[model samples]
Target chain A: MHYFDCCDFTIASEIAWPVSFPASREPEVEIRYRNLPTDLGEGGERGFRFHAKPNELLICVDGVARYLIRGGKEIWIEPFPHADEDSIVAFLQSSVLGVLLLQRRFLVLNGGVFNVDGEGIALVGCSRAGKSTLAAAFQRIGASLFSDELCAIKQDSSGRMMAWPVLPALSLWENTLIQQGGDVTKLRPIRPSIRKYLVPTHAKSLSPVPLTQVVELKDYHGDLLWKTVDVKEAITLVLGNTYRHRFLIGMALKDAHFLQSTALIQQSRFYIAQRHLTVTSEDAFFHFVRTNLAL
Target chain B: MKSIVWLASYPKSGNTWLRIFLENLFFATDEPCDINNLRSSFMSCSLDLFDHECGWDVSLLSHDEIDRLRPEIYTYIDSQWENVKYFKTHCAYSFTGSGEAFFPDEATKAAIYLIRNPLDVCISYAHHRGYSDYDRIIAEMADAASCLCSDTDQPFWQARQKILSWSLNVESWLSVEGFPVLFLRYEDMKNNPYEAFSRVAAHLGVNKSELEIRQAIKNSSFEELQKQESLNSFKEKPSRSKKFFRSGQNGMGYAMLSRSQVASIIANHGQIMAQFGYL
Candidate 1:
């Protein structure tokens, strides 16, 4: 058995988590390996038919595994057909964990959250927005590492949005890795089926850091246009990048996400980082972002 | 029980132009539709839409697994929306490895399959992809598994589109065993746009008058699209292309290609070329 201090939850699991945990903390969610139910019943709605729900949330990855998160305390998993092990671990570390946090009504954002000189800077965007590339480039410039893919945001005692980091690595593309002089043979692929590597970083900010700014990256072909969004739009924008906001709707935590976004925007500045849509060099884009974000 | 219109086409085949026209036909007053902000319909292979509907990051799953789960998204959309939803797809009529249809047959009510001459497609596609090889473009057009926006080495913003050959793609939609489809030819649109667009309007169930169609046609002219692109670069334009609205003429094939190049394209797609008056 392995344990992880994930966000605020003490997660005890059958699989090892990338994040660390002290055994002193009491467990909140216990993930165990078992043959999960084939169906969670017929009356509930489908989140694209890979799921069904009544009292518990059942998620199926056909020919791979099934996951049943029961009452927000236990995760039952069933591995079927394929047992690559690498992919299953990735699932636990990423989207599956994201869904659990969201089901728990905690805000999980799909972006890069890292500590930039003690102030947390998050680069949020859809895929191809270069969020990870931005984060990796920022880290290369001696910025403190945090989380690259998923991060949890919630309220703290002082009424500020605190970003609790995730895995201490970033998934970087092969082209970007080549530009950075990274050896593809050395790094581990996030999955065997993909070329994206799990490039480990230096020390990551393990505790809750105050999220100072949220920059949404967009691939604009013209030029770099950075502008601060209004508060109303900021709320919608942040929620839009909130690690599968559709899951929030599916789990009926839309209100929770709205409240979380409101709290997050209140504490952090939101900027749309519109950049050119070309195969940019590391130094060129790095200089542009560093100058604009002023990191 | 659902109204889903498909703006289906092979790449560089005036799909964007048709979309802009539709946008103007729906919501233009004194200005042309914003080229920078013209997502009238979400694409069939949109990463955001799939991620949103599945409530998970599809990048984590293999492409095959993602394909298996795609039909479910349409089912959800059909259940949720009570009105018309147009989705653009380049994927030909295909099935998943698990034998499920890639596009949900139950959800889609109609499709608009756009056909352009292969020779024009070669020039436009070469510019769009920045690859100068006419032979490769031809081979890709004839292949059964030609697709785009599927680079796995980088952060994939676009979804993987599994479009087959030019002729196969056309056949896939037009011969779906009684599925309703409206076929629009690029030559027809270029020569007699009024007739072409009016047919489109009729198929989409839009009751635009002759004047409205004329105004929309004028509004979304090739020059206007190029002008808009020059002012504020289009988000959809590939970085390699100098402009999105390149000379969208029927004879562009002749101007851009040599006689041999034209011969190569016709030889590869002779049947479909003749069928669509390209020969």
Candidate 2:
């Protein structure tokens, strides 16, 4: 048995995870290896890979595995015959973990969070919006990465938004690795036949940090246009970028998600950072964020 | 329950022009529709849509894996979408390794397949890709394995589009049996905008008057599109390409290509070319 600390939850699992930090506390969640039913039966919303209800969700990857997460407390995994271990674990860390957090009613965005000085700054966007790349650049420039690919957020007693730290490594494409001046030939791909690699950062925070700013990276061809968004726009932006937002309606958490977004925007300043597609250097990105966020 | 109408084409065809025309026809106004804010049609290969509907980060999935789930994703979208949604795609009509159609019949209303001459596609596609080599472009159009955004080295905002060769792409759409497909030649669109666009409006069941159709045609004219592109740069313009709306002329293929390049394209796609009046 292995225990890991992730997103403020101590999880006990049958499979050892390389990404999360080892936990020494009583577990709040349990991951077990068992056979999952092919069908969840009627009366729930269905997606390509998942079936969601108010308290349960099932994620099925044809050749990888079927994962059933219930009530944010237990995860049942059924690995397919001859499934690649790395691919199964990758899904477990990404989609499985993300759904569990949402089941716990936490506000999760599909992006990365990095600690700048003592505060957490979230860089959120859809895929290829340079979230992981910018987070990697921030790490190189002395910021501590809290998580990448999924940013789970919560609130303290004083109503301040806090970012719960997850995995310490960043999943970067081969081109990004090359641009970051790292040797690609030495690192193993995240999964066999995939070009993305998991590169551990020099600095990472295990504890939660105050999330002060949320920046949405947009891909624009022309000059970089950075602007602060009002609360209404921020709510829309945050909801649009929410991780697995389609699951909200199916899980009957639409109102909760909205309340979370409203609460988050109240605490964190939101901005849209349109990065010029032509700007390729890491230093340029680091300088841009530093100048815009005044970090 | 079919709700999706696919604006399917090979690269550099009149897909964008048709989309702009439809936008003007449906949402008529004093000014032309913003090329950036195209509310009429959404991209079928959008990374965000896949992530939202599939409930997984597409970056973590392989191209084949994503392709396998595409039909289910479309079904999910169709279930929730209220109106008849138009989706633009460059992917050729094909099936996944699991023997399922990429565009499922249950979710697909119809497909408006746009075909340009391989000879001309060679010219426009070279520009769109920022390549000066006509020989390389012709070779890719002939190779059946050609695909768009299939590189694994970097992530893309759009999903991997399996375009195949120019001839194969056109043939694939023309041969689909499950759904009705309306094939519109790019040459016909240029030479006879009235008849071609009228056919498009009728096929889409848009109840626009004759005057509205004419006005939409005028509003989305090649010149107007070029002017708009100049005034406000098109978001769809490739990072490498200078402009999205290049010369929309008919025979740039013959004008630019060397004798050997023209012969190579003709040799590869002569059958489809002759059938479509390109011969």
Candidate 3:
């Protein structure tokens, strides 16, 4: 089995994953390649090709594979015939990983996290909100990469909310790679057909760090604006940016998710940063973040 | 279980106008409802809604993959939503790669299709897109594979909608056998507001007094809409566009297009336009 350290947990997977950190402890989670049950019996929420129960979720992406995540401990994947390794691995890294984190009760954000100084500052937003772009920029200026795409956070025994490190790769579009002064043709695409290239980071944080700020990046045509969120709004922002938050209700973790968000908000700062799409420069964004956040 | 009534139309048609009218009709406020804050209708292709309802990141999925899941997402929303919901869409009535209807009958109560003359639509569409490329717009209108928000290079907040061509869009909605479709013309709505909107009220079973209809028509008039737009810019307006409610006239568009431009539209959509009295 291939062993890796992800989300502060030792993951022993039968399928090879592209994470950077090696497992330092015994396995807390096991990923096996097995045939998942076709049905979940009854009383579960369903999407087009998936079903979700309180502690189990069966996701079937046509032509890719079927993944059954159960009880936060194990993930069973059944790949479709003729499916490429990249496609299967892409789902495993994203949606399957996200479901597993939710089952483990971590406050996961669908964005990237980076270590600024010693604190974990998360940049959360919807898809294409420039989270990876900003994280890449932060890393260029000496910030250490903690996570990309999915950021998992949990309260440690010391009552400090910590951002758990995930895979040490950032998936960036072609334009973003060019803008970041990287050669796109040399980088491999995340999936064979997709234009997004997976750029591996050299400076990766393996251990969890104390979580401090969660900034929601917004793409707008107007001037750059920053809105300071109150604790109540901060809770909403955290929940809204939570990775696949719609699954919380289906998985019967709405109350638990809300509580986790409340606790996270109590310890961390939250802000909504609107970046002008056309006029604002990347340097301007970095300066704004550095100035307003005092990083 | 079906609670959604689609306000389906092509771009720059009377879809927004009908939405405004419905907003006024339902609330019956002293003053007109805010153009930016219309609660009557929601867009069908909102990416955030898709992401929330489908319990996944849509950006990770291919456009065809997203299309396959849209029916199920809409059904989920229909099951959860209590009241009758009106969703505005610029998508033509079409099926996914898996042969599933994009606007599934199981989740749809009915539909209101607002069709306009292609000649006028071309002019308004150019303005709405903040461009004056009439020839390009004309060509796009005749291309069967035309769509809205189809850009793949950049991230957009809305999902892609395949609207097809002018004739195909009209034909597709007209051929729907699963649910009732109240096909209204933009010209008729502008000319006979009472008769046109009364049909709208009847189709959706929104019973209103005669005075209510009159007041709603007055509140949703082109002048009132223009005035409201001038006061506070409409949120749906493209940033490059100067105004959203620009000259809600009929024949003015026909007069503006070149002789060849009008002939091209007639050649492309002659049959459909004639059927709708637009010719």
lDDT of 1 by residue, A1-295 (tens): 8876767777888877554544448888888989777776665546663453533667766555777876668888888777666777777677777777776666777787888667888888876677788798888778876777776777888888888766667788888898788999987787788787877774633677899988887777677777888889897778678786555554667777778888888788888877776745546766877888876
The residue pairs found clashing in candidate 1 are none
- In angstroms, the error of model 3 at A90 is 1.7
For A1-295, candidate 2 gives per-residue lDDT tens digits of 8987887779999987766776858999999999889868897888767899888899887778999999999999999999887888888988899889999888999899988777899999877788888888878768889888899898778877789888878999999899779898888788886899988763434778888899998876556678999988998889879988767777888898888888898889999888655444556766787799987
lDDT per residue (tens digit) for residues A172-221 in model 3: 87777887788987877766756677788865457788889989987654
Model 1 residue B258 CA deviation (Å) reads: 1.8
- The true-versus-predicted C-alpha distance at residue B112 of model 1, in Å, is 1.6
- lDDT at position B213, candidate 3: 95
Against the true two-chain complex, what DockQ does each candidate achieve? 0.52, 0.59, 0.26
Q: Over 4 Å off in model 2, which ranges?
A: A41-44, A202-205, A276-283
Instruction: Kindly list the per-residue Cα lDDT of model 1 for residues B221-272, writing each as its tens digit.
Output: 9999999888887878777777778778777888878888888778878988
Fraction of the native A-B contacts that model 1 recovers: 0.62
Q: Which candidate comes out best when scored by TM-score?
A: 2
Docking class of 3: acceptable
Model 1 chain B: weakest 10-residue lDDT segment is: B52-61
1 or 2, greater by DockQ: 2
Question: How many steric overlaps does candidate 2 have?
Answer: 0
